[model samples]
Target: MRKALTLLGTGLAAALALTACGGGNNASAPSAAATLDPANPTTVTVGATPTPQAKILEFVDQKLAKEAGIDLEIKEFDDYQTPNIALSDGSLDANYFQHLPFLEDQMKTKGYKFEHGAPIHIEPYAGFSAKHKKISEIPDGATIAITNDPGNQPRALKLLESAGLLKDIKDDSSALTLSDEQNPKKLKFEENQPEILLPLVKDPKIDMAIINGNYILDAGLNTDDALVVESVKDSPYGNFLVWRAGEETPAIAKLEELLHSPEVKAYIEKTWPNGDVTPAF
Candidate 1:
């Protein structure tokens, strides 16, 4: 029997309500300056995924934000789409659950005008299997699970390419997709939302699943158990903090500074010592 896992639900209705109130594309413009005095703490509401992104913010809120005159309020989102939607609709001050590739794609396709801070950390993509102990053991025509999002679909396909399961992936990000001709192993792919891939890997029919590192941690799966892991050196998939363009305030800048601070880097290293989550700074 597959073990049950708890997944956080997206705030779709709240986001919709906010969007309907002129908060969608033409939301209220950000305040021209910090509304609060520098000496007073300003509250910044952020949306994030449940695992490392939110966990990292909780650490900063508890250990560092007070001294910086910032009060961090984090709203956790399970699905990848909602955080950006919430940010676009003014339901959040900022969000911190995506990489540059994903961020760029969202901006281009959704017409969201956003800016992001420097990369904070890299959650190395990995492939896990309950049916096979090694990549070599995954036979031809096996069913593999991957994320359906355009930004991450290429990543899953790239991981498969690196493992020698596929070949000749298009260099252009938008053109990449699952191709039987490219897949030498004849591996069948099952696509789902990023959050669902972890649970699907446990299904007896799934031969393997390429999962995001944060999801791997959320499911309490050891990174060491991965049959193959993406190399972190110069990896372009580092996750970072994002906010509305031209809306950045002192409080948001402070939070960005704190995120790249040595303290936060140390905390990430300590918490995920196995290199599942590595500081990009």
Candidate 2:
């Protein structure tokens, strides 16, 4: 049997490791120093977001892990920052929530030694609103809630530009800040933590919010409800599995194999029929 833990709030203190089944003495131990034995089922503790990330892992744990000799344990995180923090501190064997750009930013800024597998899926970024049905409905000088993280803020801004809300955006492959030159409508932006952007958009004062597809799913909001959805065609924002450098084991390899298997791809397509989450492989 597998286990799941929900981590709310920020910081390393909130990222308590969950015990995996059959992990007797090493239940609370980190996988960094564990020995790899191909004959035995390896217990891998992975951190992920609550929606499609954890759900996808749960599917693999229940249906595919045993035959592949992998014992999966999943930890659910509400925020984007904590997973990598947990991984860096040896709290998780791996994580499966971020894309290449976000991972690159984290590694460069924090000096994390990490490696990742191929892109597993894409959670299309989109603009959402509770008060407005379309982008044209947003009035000038309206406040729009978005993620404050540099990794995703540019994505949100690009989505807004596609919707004709912003223009003349110059992204220099670095963390971008919104300026008056890009704000044609003079729309004010309220940047908050990614997890909070959902609820912030619901507020009457906030006009709209650009949120990742997973958060929208977790909140019971339909992807069809989004005012402007990011295109998946040739999109570089595909989420993948990540682990510490040189920590890969046979079990981890098996997990990665199962992750990109036809079963997982079919499962993703079947589960997220609305195209909120699509297989990238």
Candidate 3:
């Protein structure tokens, strides 16, 4: 049987020791002297976004990690930026919330060196709207809201291009200004935090919103409701496990193995059917 998952929220600051199942008097007790032991039981702290990412990690910790001498500590972050920040600062042993494009942008722009594990899964990005029923209905000066995340903004523009509202442009070079010529509708863009895009799109004032897959799932809106969704098979936005460069340890390796384990794949497929979430491995 799977044990209950232990989770730490964003507010948690101090390091907490985690004891493997049946190794301590109380599994939930937090200890400050936690250390890693390759040959024996070890604790690993990972930062992750809630929903599927944290939930998936929780599953691995409960079901497979203990037997492998791995005790997983999951810290949940509400935003995309914090997980990487925590990972880079050594606050977290690893993080499992972002795709490669985002990782590249973080490393290139923020000057952080990190190493990532194998592809874990893809949370399809989608376009949603409250004002327009179809792509053609958008007015000439309509406003479109998108994630301000550097890696995701270009992706949102590409989705707009596919919807027949803009022209195709190279990836990673897109911005609000670049869309002027290709934009037949002369659409305006509002860049904000990814999570904020959901409510903004639902507003009658906003024409469309490009929301991240996990946020969409949390909103309880069906993917079919999206104005347009990215292709699952070819999407490059597969989320994975990432850690500080040159910091990979035995505990990290074991956790990575458990993430790609059959149990996780089955859990993802069963938890989210109809391609709402797809295993990238």
TM-score rank order = 2, 1, 3
Question: What's the residue-level lDDT of 59 in candidate 3?
Answer: 86
Residue lDDT tens for model 2, 1-281: 45667555564432332211111111121233344453677899999998899999999999988877788899988888778778877889999999977887677666677888888999998888889998889999988888877777788888888889888665432123556677868888887878778888779998988888888899888878888999999988999888877665767777887899999999999999989999999
> What TM-score would every model get versus the actual structure?
0.86, 0.87, 0.84
Model 2 — which ten-residue stretch has the worst lDDT?
20-29
Candidate 3 displacement at residue 23 in angstroms: 38
Select the stronger candidate by TM-score from 1 and 3: 1
User: Between candidates 1 and 3, which one is better according to lDDT?
Assistant: 1
lDDT for model 3 = 0.75
Q: Evaluate all candidate structures by whole-model CA lDDT and list the values in order.
A: 0.79, 0.79, 0.75
Where does candidate 2 clash, by residue pair? Answer: none
lDDT, model 1, position 196: 73
| lDDT score for residue 179 of model 1 | 61
For model 1, the run of ten residues with the poorest summed lDDT: 20-29
The C-alpha stretches of model 3 lying farther than 4 A from their native spots are 1-40
Off by over 4 Å in 2: 11-39, 172-179
* Candidate ranking (lDDT, best to worst): 1, 2, 3
Tens-digit lDDT track for model 1 on 82-185?
77777887878999899977877677667778888888999988999989999999899889888877888888787888899888776443222446578777
Candidate 1 backbone collisions, by pair? none
